[model samples]
Target: MKKPLIFVYFFLLISPVFAQMEFGFDDKDAFSPHSIRQVRRADVMYNNTVWVRMDLREKQNEPFFAANSEITKIIIDAVKAGVLRPYKNDSLITRMSIQEFNDNIKIPGADEGLTDEDLAMGFGDSDFGGGDDWGGGDWGSEGGAEEDAGPDEFFPNNIYILELKEHRMFDRKRSRMYYDIQSIKLIIPGELYPTGINKELATFSYKELVSNVFVDNPAAVWYNAKNTAENKNLADAFELRQFTGKIVKYSNPKDNVIDDIYKGNLKLGLAKSQEYEHRLLEYESDLWSN
Candidate 1:
């Protein structure tokens, strides 16, 4: 009887351990879609999601926009080839079809009333000047009716802004903090549009990007200006954080961006963004305190 009671007590004491192990095994992939590391939910002591905006035209980010192998071009081509899945937003819940992706990236008035043959002819002076009526027949009229010349479609260079959504978390199991990127968004600058409102093309899962798009592609390169032989894969460049980005927002109760919180004061918002960066660094140090 004494032996049985001891065995029963020991089982109860170790039951929680077994339960924890099972939970970790089952839910290890919960964050896998967005994170390279398999972090268990129970091990996450703290978490904060942040949004960052990167300007590819910036000197520090020029490698991502290198000639002939721009990151934007690689991603856009992959989407068009049906090899990548685009999301409607950073939530990654809803998927945007290929048609939707195309429409989003297209310029407002591009390709309007233009046929394949018209496109093939090219928008050249010679092509529109051979007519005998009013130096190309009124220039803005077709078949005795006025016509509007639509705006041109977007080019890879026009997509200069990249938005990243990532979670900064402290994992108790690893006793370290991790920046787990979730999604990336492409943005056409507001200046490109008449209304001056920036347009979001589409969001993509970083998991798919790292696994499928950037991993083995030869064209996805991070150009090395100093050393021609030292060019790195885009995936490795991202892992090294070889780019500069400004924090636009962080996890907050109101879901407000830095600009919104500072009432659109650009200087104040920039300072606030810096403050948040410092706080994140200080947080890890604080955790080590006695």
Candidate 2:
């Protein structure tokens, strides 16, 4: 009787080990209310992190694809309210009517090689230039930036500005009512760029590469700090539908950069919005679970 009782005791202690082995225990699979592992993320950003492009030039009928238009309107409102900034990329090309083009071309300078209007049509300037830093930090004294400004003056130089770099809406046929996000770039603040050794001009750091919707997408190289309801973060602001735009190609070409072979599939474009919503739900579910 004593030996049987001892054997039963050993069996009870050893059974769980075998069960754990069978199930294959891992940090992600195991959970405890008392302890939680914070997900590690990169501090600095780099180019090609998580960029998305939306094109809203397509015209859709009522209720079918109207979310595209509605989403864009919300984004435009955020921009106007100073909640989000639109990047005036010089690369953007706006379509002009034939009569409008002709009317504008009737300038004082007739021929003489090429007119300013013609050149303007070929290439235009966007407001995303590195003019006075977006955040209102006073300029350094007359001597020089280094001579007048202290390290404190330079460390937290300007408020980081968010901009949608590639915004384009061509006057094409209103076949599919939609807007397009030609490309999304996460431009870093100018003050953060590394100043040349000779002080000639500051250059963007490797971590400051342009590309990625740093606000909405958190898994990328940018989402590091935590945010509360009192103070909102980029991801929080974006979750409020602060970005509105059209989709050019539903299948982003940059998807090729990842091991996700199915992401850039052209076939998936037809059901993209649905697929995206599903993903969002899954992401939200993951927040509390695991």
Candidate 3:
């Protein structure tokens, strides 16, 4: 069971966003398809560790925009040149406090007894990367779907928020410059249980099974990516900010023996999730269509 969960978590952290985004360029200018802007993501091993940087032009950055020369590339290039580094490794990001976690992370039937202290403590000890994992414990089991929606839980799971300040475009020849700060939230899937009883059950044998059996629910606790533009007017002059993320392949998050969730190692895990998500969406659509 732990093996599968570990694999699934990897896929969730690395998979790219395939949905097409609309840049709202008159609804007819297909040239301005949604361009990915930020590419940073949280780490599964380190609580505050960021896996990637926001600039779109890095050895790690990939295509984020539908068009050829989107700002994502520009940002990436800047990162390579030391012009921009929106996210860093050593920096400490301010997140929600314990009270905020309860107010925001609680699921529909989540045990009220569970507190933020419990979560923080769990995170501190859960072998984030040093090979000292408390496998088969509550950290991987409790807090189901609700964990996926909230920022505190999800961001730590590999999703990240990359903000760009004072972004502007100028008609250099015309001597006019417009500036605004931009924020992008990117959802990077991490080690999470998808929606399926068999998948969850497979993680642990009957002997390893405990009171809280993980269900193979995709929404159980995953991350997502997004992009927001503060200055809408700049869309015409420059471009709407974007977010892009990627997943790498590694043996483990634990330094000793645990493997890190990376690409290519979790194909089947993702396929199962896709099938499950498809059925669920179909079922919901049918139910609502009536």
Candidates' C-alpha lDDT: 0.78, 0.29, 0.27
TM per candidate: 0.78, 0.23, 0.19
Candidates 1 and 3 compared: the better one by TM-score is 1
Q: Highest TM-score among the candidates is held by which one?
A: 1
Q: What is candidate 1's lDDT per residue for 1-290, written digit by digit as tens? A: 69999999999999878756755554444645467665888788899999999999999999999986788877776664445778899999999865566567767766665677877766311111223221233211111212222235467778899999999888887687888888999998999889999999999999898886787677779999999699998889988889999999999999999999999999999999999988988997898672
lDDT of predicted model 3: 0.27
Please give, for residues 142-217, the per-residue lDDT of candidate 3 as tens digits. 2221212232232232222222222222222223332222233222222332532111000111111111221232
Candidate 2 residue runs with Cα over 4 Å from true position:
1-49, 56-183, 186-239, 244-267
- The clash count for each model shown is 0, 30, 36
Which segments of model 1 are wrong by more than 4 Å?
1-24, 27-32, 113-152, 288-290
Off by over 4 Å in 3: 1-68, 80-83, 88-267, 275-290
What would the TM-score be for candidate 1 when compared with the true structure? 0.78
Q: Write the per-residue lDDT of candidate 2 for residues 103-144, one digit (tens) a residue.
A: 221222333445678556542221211323222222233211
Query: 254, model 2: CA deviation in Å?
Result: 9.2
